[model samples]
Target: MIERPITDWLPLTMKEVEKRGWDEVDIVLVSGDAYVDHPAFGTAVIGRIMESEGFRVAIVAQPNWKDDLRDFKKFGKPKYFFGVTAGCMDSMVNHYTANKRLRSNDSYTPGGEAGFRPDYATTVYSKILKELYPDVPVLLGGIEASLRRVTHYDYWQDKLMPSILVDAGADMLVYGMGEQPLREILKLARQGVPFSSMRNINQVAFMHDARTPLADYNDWSTVELASHETCLKDKIKYAANFKIVEVESNKWQANRITQQVGNQVLVINPPFKTMEEAEIDKSFDLPYTRLPHPKYKKRGPIPAYDMIKFSVNMHRGCFGGCSFCTISAHQGKFIASRSEKSVLKEVDEITKHPEFKGYISDLGGPSANMYKMKGKDESICARCQSPSCIHPVICSNLDTSHKPLTELYRKVDANPAIKKAFVGSGVRYDLLVDDFNKNNNDGNHDEYMEQLVTRHVSGRLKVAPEHTADDTLRIMRKPSFKYFKLFKKKYDQIQEKHNLKQPLIPYFISSHPGCEEQDMANLAAETKDLGFQLEQVQDFTPTPMTVAEVIYYSGVHPYTLKPVKTAKTRDEKQAQNRYFFWYKPEYKDWIRNRLNKLNRPDLVERLLGSKTGNSGKTTSSGNYSGRKKR
Candidate 1:
């Protein structure tokens, strides 16, 4: 690979392309986000990887799809193909809130602006590209394409939609992490294999005629899912399909997944194995400037870039497999950690930056303490299909040690240029509780807790408890609230021992599946007793490819296929969400009335305040006749 300056960002225009002495580009990539040449941004990482692989790549960020064909025609056509992405997050998730309200700001945009990217960004961008240059092949990837690679439930539309490739009119869809599949695709294309003939690559999905035989791909075993038409007509089949899709996704040796969308057969090849440590390190070691493209310097800072520019991602993938999360689905459940030497080298690089402030913002991944943590036996894990390693009690064969992570934290902070290193990502509090780690005889649980609370906390530590109800937590694949109680006790004890004032901010979700009004009331009363005002609360927003979303859309659990109750209506969901703000004076009367209607005065008194005897009681005559005759 040619050596480029660390400060050099990839070209964003034809002018930079000319300066590099490139007559024609091989791949012209388009995205729905402002160009930030940091590893945290997906577009930058993909472009840099392609550039390192001897391909001339140019990026068009946040292109205007509503206006003329200018943004699409800036670089004309490419020699190979056009790569399109919906930024790091799905466009619908970026544009709308959980309540389906249009969001006021986009973190991926310059100056925190909204409306720069259109709705359903991947499809919109791909459609514009095909319209302008009909013959060029368009490829789709990123979270939106990965999760929607097959028939999926759309929360905003409240309907089942076909594969995004069908809607976008793209030639191919690269699901999951794109490094391995992309390398193969580009290699095959460069060898004169047309994009249409490139159908056998792993982790790539495309459409075929219904009559096409499965034997065409003789090496892969295929599993046929219910057609998109069937899912729309019968939701039970839709729920059943999720079970097959999720199980295949986490398996080390997975089967190819197929679903019929209208008249076309959508075929998704099984993913490549989880990236090895060296492979992940190679992807991160690319020449990233770690700053937004210079064009955006005058447009105000990108909030997302500003937050993570100085941080080092020590690893990839999570094994937690929370039902409401897509991390495991997209990044795989196997943990792929960078070597300690690689991590420290990145830390040293960040320390030399002109913007370095003697502090590292974050040294973590999807779940911060999951570094170098995986099953004790690889052979056993290879054959296992269980989604979560910790849920339903931690696996006996799993290694839940925290010593390596603790050492990594110390090594990063030991640098003379650094003052402190913080773990900004949310840590799994369940792992710290004694009951969960009791089997492991490492004796480092308490020590790890002490180190975190003593040094890494930035005046506040964030952990998600999700909910207080046992039934809801079970549906969400989270441990019981009793574990949270134990973890909080430990956290508070460490703070007291060190004479520190850092607060433990717990995150909770409202209106999740299997939660009732009474459950939320219990949550309010319980947290209030713990002296928490409960600010970090959210109403559950169902995204694609999760157990919660399957249940929310089909009204049936994927594992059990039994009816699961959910709060679907706006009024029903809001009533449960209102309990989270029980500390506010404005919600006191409303909460009291709702609990009173449920005939649970015990909760009303607990959440609001205990009324004096006969002070506000009503009489049998439907009046306040029980009051004293004053």
Candidate 2:
């Protein structure tokens, strides 16, 4: 927001500096992710925003998310407040600890040591923030803070975290995209605004004594909201509309106990949009710094500099709400872009780096293809008001096309300096299948997408088929196996034609609440046939606000209330995962025969192990002959 506004903004910013008790210190934003100079992610982009608005900012690449004031002090007090979040927006709930703690109970672990403490990382981080900045407010935002904004079910801790706002001791929590919220915060801070007044700002969500119900407590129904015997039938009614609720704390009506101290609600006001024409370039000319300041910390929570790639923003928000996803719950379903040229300019600067080997990493917003909405003015039937898309199948009304995004990618790869460009992040295959694969015979149509995939391939391109079965995919709010099978073949055949080594990498998850032994077995069967190495086999770990996690932990999908086949113990699932690793011929002979008897002959060879005799021979160390080490 340059022009005179940002320049004029400095005076108030100075005032904000003094209000926060700081004296022209360069604020170093620290995080636990790669703050690579490139886009994709890091403090760099936000740093640029702050810079564009006429504030001083430095980036502290991946630091231990729990680093305290002393650890972060490498740069004195941030001129404003130091920004903190779980690295790369991935919550601590997704990580496990040495104690065998799974991030969440709902997290599936077909095979790994199993205890979990989803709150562990955030808690430790909260404690550190408190220890480091005793009085200085440590603002918590990003995905973790947004989703954890309320007191809800925590699958890992098996209890609750009060609310990151109260329990975490964060002075302010900004949910959704921080641009408008951050800008407002900066403006207010510079104007010497106080914490009590932050609630009034747009895009800002604060926790108060008021709270909403647990959405649907059917599964949690058996477990009281509190230790007492009371409970509510309609949790949605109890939702603490941040706009309506205000409080320090209160008692629960249903669970009937003094509601825990942390049961307050945070008012996350609607985002502030800068509609004025000047604000357009204002986003473009934002004075925030792109590269981390010269004094880049060598070691920290976010070692972004060390990562191979980066992410740049074109927009914010996703319209596609797969039920098991949190993008809607947190960011809302809106799309915001920072000018296409702005993104390209950001890429140019990245390519300028000597260490950069011409690899222009992904260029995307929430969903890469969704750089622009389907129809700017068309009425979008938000099929499901759910945090996730309510509809299982692709909504015909929602526009899904590849024209604009295709051009963007073309412009990027066209830069001869960039040896290759890849959309490494998740590409909504359903959208791709429609826009590129639907066979409209609509001019160079298929050829266009094939080129995009070819140019973006780096070893492999990742797409989340999540599962290979229709029933499981439907439950997971994803396209069916039919779609995955079709796309996989298309990609494979195309790769063969190009003679490129690039492979189609699909991710799979096991033990989702609704999945039973047969589902897992069916997936195993698909894996054998597909011949995919499967770099990632995520077990379903339920995040607090996620519908799936709720189902797994409570033994019921909150919406369906159906008796699911969630495994109660870890041992039972680990055996299933072992199946993915056993693909040898000898093992196959035994497994195939036995699996046939088990009524799961499909998984027999893959589970027991088998081999295609035609290709390169495996050496002694890696060699095998049916079930024997020799």
Candidate 3:
């Protein structure tokens, strides 16, 4: 392996820019994350994509927003536009926990430090750029901007805020993956098209004066959502607006959406079709140092980078569309997979790293088993408006085969430089249960399970069943918990057949919409019966752009317009979460008292066991950990 020079990285400072012999840069990206030149990092990917297109790109990462305003002035202004992102994860989610407690550290920062970025970093950074530059266009991207592009709920603020464009005062916004729309934007900019005239581009959102006629570039039919003012006064109208936004977001051919907010109208164009094989491969095949910038050598490791330094993401986009998830909302429901060659090439690159440890951390995407899986029929998928392909029931048009993924894992393992490649991402367990998916008519399901358990099991295999109660599961867009039982039965058989001892860890959530105290008690009792003491649990926090979040704010399901009960108060949330730790001594008496008050002493006995000091502890079960997918 060759050592990379400092010049191998995208210029992060003026000194590095001077080394490149560039008097000025074309595009300057301001990010809330430290500059890690890896494809997994959004700032790095956007910078490299611009550089590939013959643009001089410079990055100002984790710029000081509170001090002298020097960081904003350092790069001055770019020739094209300034791109801003809140880093890999949303800043609020990074800075706060589910209980709204200020987190002590940020995984994306050097030394896992907090305070490197501000709350609503995108809005902060963009506002700063507009105030400082005043003349240059400010373009927004990344998950923070993408998910907040509409009138959505903000749990931290406990209010419904208008599109981020209104607050940020930016010229344009790119939603979703940004790669496809970015390329088109670059082409138009090269042709000398003004930034304000980019309304025709797909996946781009911007504000237009309400008094003017809305421009129709592609002649796309438009759907108007209830105004932000209307959502504030009428919760039912707010819930109804979400249904239109979600359906169009997942459709193959979608209508342009607009919403009135104050004097300006927000225009969000339909997204481009999913990326093809060569297109997605191009994004991954760019020149990357695959390391954090050298300036961070003494600051300690970025926890997010360290976790994925040896991993390979085979694809992007998740079709699971869980109610609490933002994956489909931001990445779209369609899958954009790389060619097998691209994935294997990335694996080879990992093995050549100087810190190569003969182990690959993850060889998965948004969901581990969703590689190369999509709708079996193109026309059917085009006409489909459903957000989840495998929730409630698996779509007959969907292809749930796991053969390609199984074969890919074998190829990676066969590389003599690699000792093991584990799938660290959460696997969609329902896809493996034949009773639910019914698409695994061939032996692919069993064969994939055997391969995964025998080779990829890194002590335990984690799956997310979310919750146990059927009523709660329905609102979560999850299959019945019975399917999880069948999946577990099959998983255990595979383990026994292979003579392996890997524990199967399942995750659950409390305080989600449609869940009640009795439902939580049932969850505790049912899991206790399985000889497991649950450790993986979380109280649901409502984030923007999710169905559960809408329900939490509006008190009704967006799809059905029916009232759904949610645990919102601190006491209510705490009560539901306590059920997860029923085995802990501190919570043992509380569980007994709470269950007795609910008038179900049977639950107290089932969870805490007979009063003769039955500890309710599992002798040899693995501890479950909670998952909060951003």
Candidate 4:
């Protein structure tokens, strides 16, 4: 059970149940993939909220998320209901996994195909629910169903149709943080409330009005279908790349395929300014119950449970507005945080792990180093989910930095059993470098950086430089080279004083929006000079809901408000990647010869890309954010 603070206002239902003296209400929240005992978004937070409201909630994460008719027997029709998400919780995983088809739905499954896609999973969940529960209302909440709640575009069948409601067989969907919506639903349900009566709940995404026929699940341009077919099972893959085309006029469908099924078709709603409504203290006042996670799954490609994954969230949300990231899409614009004491408690528990050799802890969130909570008067810019902020560069509103985090690191280090603490999550270099000289209210300054080096890492710290070119990064919403230079300089000095030979790990991406040949030339040149082993070069895969993915689809960065080009072929990507290897002695001469043959002599260093993710960057959090959403 969660050990939350006493004064914080708990969910209304939680309070009501406690007041009413009820033991438990039977309820089940279903998903499409393996269950993570912890809450990434809905699992824990929503589950906790449910318990707070005095209802019993069980997360059946990662069920056979499909629209097929047969897969619904696991949790026989619950007396309460089912909650649905995509393949891997949300579009975020789909982004990281590169839109490849998952292995579960082999060629033999009725609606199965290779390459990771959440649709197949949702389809399975829907079909099973329809066949089994018949009348029990199924609610879809996660990214897959939420983002596709309208008839805007479909990547799979290459043509738009109605909402996932019809496709997945769920009666309705509640988007964003299900806290508010679920709380409302539960309160209403306990009082004998129906779905129609609970329509006014906040953060809920239901079929809008009754006039039109929302498109079908398989509706979209061929480009969308092609990529969705190839992406791995993750939430972002389904969300990243979609062009928002407004209805030509306000023409409803000629014939409503599923008349009542038509909710309003959603294009893109401004991220629900989750800030004004978010009760941070209440949100964070979770039970200090560091209990074992029975829902934890085994790791893939090796031993499943490697000392049970424990996570420490340093920050949340992205102002970077990268087209390919969905943290901005899912978590909303606000950056919420826990107090240092809270973080320390979590770390202390982690140190108690039986397998604690102290290799690494997942000290990450959307952007690990971005624990900077902004000031109260963000009056200059009210929240808008239009995919960007109107800032000149990085917003100054971020008063919360990682200084306390560093101190917590030091305290954790004080434990003799914990030999090291790695930042396994994304190091928002931009955030860390932001007031580098000015030691802030968080107690210490560069000490965090030093700890990042001397303690967490074995030798290198992974930093996502994303792309070397300014234009590309501008589109990607990542920091500029000047920032990297400063980070590298700080990193180098720290390395020298500590007599640490570890190189600063920096990752680069190829074929992002707005990348020109000269950009590739510049990247190659940068890579060759960086002098570190560049292990991996990545090709761009557009996931759903990310600004970058929009750039991939529209050929423009949503924030930059500019036109861009996506690389058209594998050969083009190969050509760009070739530059990264020119510095390796083993392949240098040969690669150099090829570069010379192409008449591009200066573009070697820029070509470097590292699979190890900037082996020089320091972090103890093993859960790294790939291609950090600006």
By TM-score, the best candidate is 3
User: How well does model 4 score by local distance difference test?
Assistant: 0.52
> Local distance difference test, per candidate?
0.85, 0.52, 0.90, 0.52
**Candidate 1's residue-wise lDDT over 1-630, tens digit each?**
123442376778888888888899999999999988878899998999898889999999998788676888899899999999999898998888889999999889989999989888999999988988999999999998898888889999988888899999999999888999999998998898998788888889999888766545647888999998999899999999998998888888889999988778998888888888898888888877777887876788898888887888888888888998999888888888998988998899899888789989888898888898887888899888999888888888788888998888888878999999987888889989888666558777777788898989876787888789999999999999999889888887888888987777777888899999899999987877766776546788899988999999999999999999999999999899888787666777898888999999999877777644322221111110111000
**Per-residue lDDT of 1-630 in model 2, one digit per residue for the tens?**
112222222122344445545456644565554443333443445666777677776544434343234445555566567676654444454464212364432211112112312234444555565777776667776677767665555655554445666667777777655666787788877877766666655555455454554232212121113311111223332222211121111101111112334345444344443222344335545543344333223322223333323545566666555545666556555455455676677778668666678776666655666665443333333222333321455444444455667777788877778777777556666655543344333434355468666777656666667676677666677767777777766776787788876656566676666666666666766655666543335666566555565555555545555555665468655644544444444344544554677886446544443444322122211111111000
TM-score for each of the candidates? 0.95, 0.72, 0.98, 0.72
- lDDT of candidate 3? 0.90
Of candidates 4 and 1, the better by lDDT: 1
Q: Write candidate 3's Cα lDDT for 156-253 as tens digits.
A: 98988999999999999999999999999999988889888888999999999999999777879999999999999999999999999999999988
Error of 3 at 104 (Å): 0.4
Could you tell which candidate, 1 or 2, scores higher by lDDT? 1
lDDT of 2: 0.52
lDDT of 4 by residue, 158-251 (tens): 3334556666766667755555566667888888777655544444545435464333332321111213232223223323323231110001
The reply for model 4, stretches above 4 Å from the true place, is 1-25, 40-45, 59-71, 87-119, 146-166, 212-308, 357-360, 381-392, 414-418, 434-445, 557-562, 583-599, 604-630
For model 1, where is the 10-residue window of minimal lDDT? 621-630
Name model 2 segments beyond 4 Å from true.
1-42, 56-83, 90-138, 209-266, 270-304, 308-315, 364-366, 376-391, 434-447, 496-501, 533-536, 584-598, 601-630
